[model samples]
Structures are given as structure tokens and as C-alpha cells.
Target: MDTDTPAVSAADSRVRRPPTADERTTLVAFLGWHRETLRVKCAGLTAAQLADRVLSPSGLSLLGLVRHAAETERFWFRTVMAGEPFEGLYAGDGAFDVARADERTVDEAWAAWRREVEFGERFVDEARDLDVAGDEPGEGPVSLRWVLMHLLEEYARHNGHADLLRERLDGVVGL
Candidate 1:
């Protein structure tokens, strides 16, 4: 291993190492960092604060964004990456409220978000060698390159919403 490799605890064996390619690694780093940024935005807020509808007329909130992102990660990683069924959580036919507040909603959403991030990390880990062919069977395939670029875009876009909502929530700004 490189001497510069960051030391990790045995308990955190699943933690992935960053790619070595300066540019490519930079892109991936931004997405991964921003994902956590979104998580930070939702931190320490109450359920009511998380479910605040004033953030958007359509009822978008930090909690809802978490749910949406978790589902989005599942859609792309599980459904598209692993070719698994797309019938996982939050399959509510574009209904934003489907991810609305509930007792276990936030917990479930965070679990899923973490799971999807790990899933993404695994994909990228093995992605250095393999070429992911087109999108899906009935859906016209896209290249793995496209998927990577798109995921970065997805997190970046949502992080923008997260930025604004977090600002309104506690006035925290500029990560």
C-alpha cells in the first residue's frame, strides 16, 4: 500500500479508498462530499423542521430530499447497476408526498441513503476495469461513464436544494 494511504480502523473495513486519477477522483470526491453535505444540512433538526413544507410549495423538505435521493440511488444503483427490481422503497409514481413525514420515515430514509452510497462506492470500486454496457433492456442502455457523470450531476443538483433549505432552517451556508 502507498505510505500516504489513510489509515482506517479494522471496524471500518468497508470504507473505500479514493481513486488515484486526479481529475476523475476530483469529480467523484465532489459528489461523495456533497452527499454528506446534504446529510449535514438535515442534522439536528426536528421532525417538524425536517418536514417543513415552506421550503417548497410542492412540500419539498430536507427529509423529503433524503427520501428522494435514497430512492434515486436505489433506482440507479440497484435497478440499473445490479439490474434488480425497481420496486423498492418510495415507488409512489412521482408523488412527492409519498416520502412525507412519519415515525420511522426518517430513519428508513437515512438507512437507504447510506446503503445506496455504499452501493455506489462498490460500483465505482469495480468499475475501473469493466465497461457497463447500455442503460437497460427495454430502456435503451447508457454507458457506465454516463452513469458516473449523471450521478455526480444528480447529487450536485439536489445539494443545491439542500443548500437553500438548510439556509432557511438554521442559516448555515457555503460548505
Candidate 2:
């Protein structure tokens, strides 16, 4: 667990930048920040490192976080926003847990996560400043503000995991 390498190497351009004013810039900045945070967490690790399950006995890994966060964005934005059905990438109902990893499977997992993040970005860009209420059945009405706040919460929780996992993988810690 001592890789001790920066996730964003000297050449990778996905490092964090300054955030903008919330009143003007929307929550996309915040969301993007966390997404990049996870990407950085997965940095400098091999495919085996990315898919390592030692963080949890049930197969949670940095790669799992990447996949989970992406699907989460899609679940909230696509299913909740566009009313689409859920056919998740890494989850199955009534299953014991997510699958044990293979190289090809983990690669697909990473791709699915990234694709959903991109899709969510497009959704947010189109919905900028357009407040809409959630119409998902059995859920209370929610504004875009609520959605954004929830996303921030989600990202924050995962970022904590990213911090610990990154630290465990390497000695690097702090923001």
C-alpha cells in the first residue's frame, strides 16, 4: 500500500483548480472538483491497484468509487431528471454484492463511470439556472438546488474515502 506516487503526475492536467462563486457559477464546479478528486485518487496505480479490494472485504476499491460515483450521477440526473429506467453498471438487485474483479471487467467499469460523468455534465450544462422539481414517484419534490446540494454531499463522502484510500495507497495526504 505504499505506491507513494501522485495520482496526477507532472503531465496529467486533471488537477484541482480554484472554485468560483456559488451565486454565479452553479454547482457544476463543485461536482467537477469532486469527480477530479476521485480521478486523482485512482492516479498512479496499476489496473490491479485501481481494482484492489483490500479497502473492504466486500470489494470496494478506488475503481469502485469511480464506477459508483458515475452511476450515482446518472441515477440522480438521468433517472431522476429524465425519468429513465435504471440498469446499473456495477449493481444488481438482490445480488450478494458487486462482482469480483477481472482486468476486462474493471476496464469496462471505469469506462461506464467516465461516460456517466460526461453525460451528467451535459445534463447540468443544459439545466443551468433552470430550477425543476423532482417528479420521481414516492420521493418528495426537490429543486435543482436540492439536487446540487445532494450531489455535493455525495461527493464529499466519497472524497473522504478517496483521501483515506490515497493515503493508504501512498503516504500522500491532505487536500
Candidate 3:
């Protein structure tokens, strides 16, 4: 653990869960909430803490989740929806590999995540409608609507993992 590691706090950073809204608004808000959920799980932790894989048999940490989330956002939105030519931020199986992660790596991971999130948000906002489809390599055409729902599912699952990892790391637990 580095003595200079700064504290992180994200308890109040999450967006309120959408109580009622249209399909797109509801989906976007829920996804945004899940995005913030990941941040909350990582709050008040140093890079060492963020990279701590306390759960054995699972090479998962808060920072790893952050990196993975960035990859996920870029893949589904930027690559699939926006049809950008691509190489991933941490291409292939590298996103979850946190063995050598330090403060710099942690910062880079978060920056990538924020960039991808912004891209995804804008992509969703500017689409003609959720019915717009993108040519997904293996799956053929996939709709923005489907992508939004799938992203919601993906974040829900990973955020659950983050919830467990965060508790194991520090015993700090909340929404």
C-alpha cells in the first residue's frame, strides 16, 4: 500500500434511479445509475485497495471492473453502434488483469471509462431512435434498443460482482 494513496469517495455520486420515464429515458437513466454504482463500489480506496483481489478463485478487483466497464462501453456503443474502426483500450484479455496495477493504471482506467461513457451517452442521445441498427460482426444487425437493454444487463451483472468485491476489500457496503 502506498502511503500517498489518496482517499476516494463516491457515496453520493450515483444518479437517482428512474422512477418513471419513457423507454429510452428509463433505459438510459438505469444504465447511468449502474455506471455510478461501479464508482460507488470503488470509493474511498487507494490504487492498492482498488486492485486488491480479496476474492480467491476470482481475479477481480474494483479497478479491474472499471477497466472492463470501459471496454464494454466502447465495444457495444463505439464499435457496434457508431461503427468505428477499432482497437480496444486494453485489447483482448488485458482489461481484467490487474496484477501490476498502480495509481497511474487506476487513473488511466477511470479516464478510459469516462471517455467511453461519454461516447455512449452521446451515441444514445443522437440516434434517430432506438430502432436504429448496427452491423454487429458475429450477430449481424443489432438494434440500438437491444444494445441498450443488453448493456443494462451487462452492468447489472458486473456491478453485482463489484458489490461483492468492494465488501470483501473493505467491508464498506451500500447502494
How many collisions per candidate?
Answer: 4, 0, 1
lDDT by residue for model 1 (1-175), tens: 1221112221222224375756557656766766766766666666666677656555677777777787777777778877787775765744246434654666666776788878977886777533575456566786666666777787778878877876887786764
Query: lDDT of all predictions, in order shown?
Result: 0.66, 0.65, 0.83
* Over 4 Å off, model 2: 1-26, 56-59, 93-102, 128-130
Over 1-175, each residue of candidate 3 has an lDDT whose tens digit, in order, gives: 2322223545567677768888989999999988877877776787888888889988888888888899989999988998998778885778898875677887788888988999999999999999999878989999999999998998999989988887887787775
Considering summed lDDT, which 10 consecutive residues are worst modelled in model 1? Answer: 1-10
Query: Global CA lDDT of candidate 2, please?
Result: 0.65
Return whichever of 1 and 2 wins on lDDT: 1
Give the best candidate by TM-score: 3
lDDT of 3: 0.83
Which candidate should be chosen as best, given lDDT against the real structure? Answer: 3
Model 1 scores what on Cα lDDT?
A: 0.66
Per-prediction TM-score: 0.76, 0.78, 0.92
Clashing pairs in 2: none
Question: Against the correct fold, how does model 3 do in TM-score?
Answer: 0.92
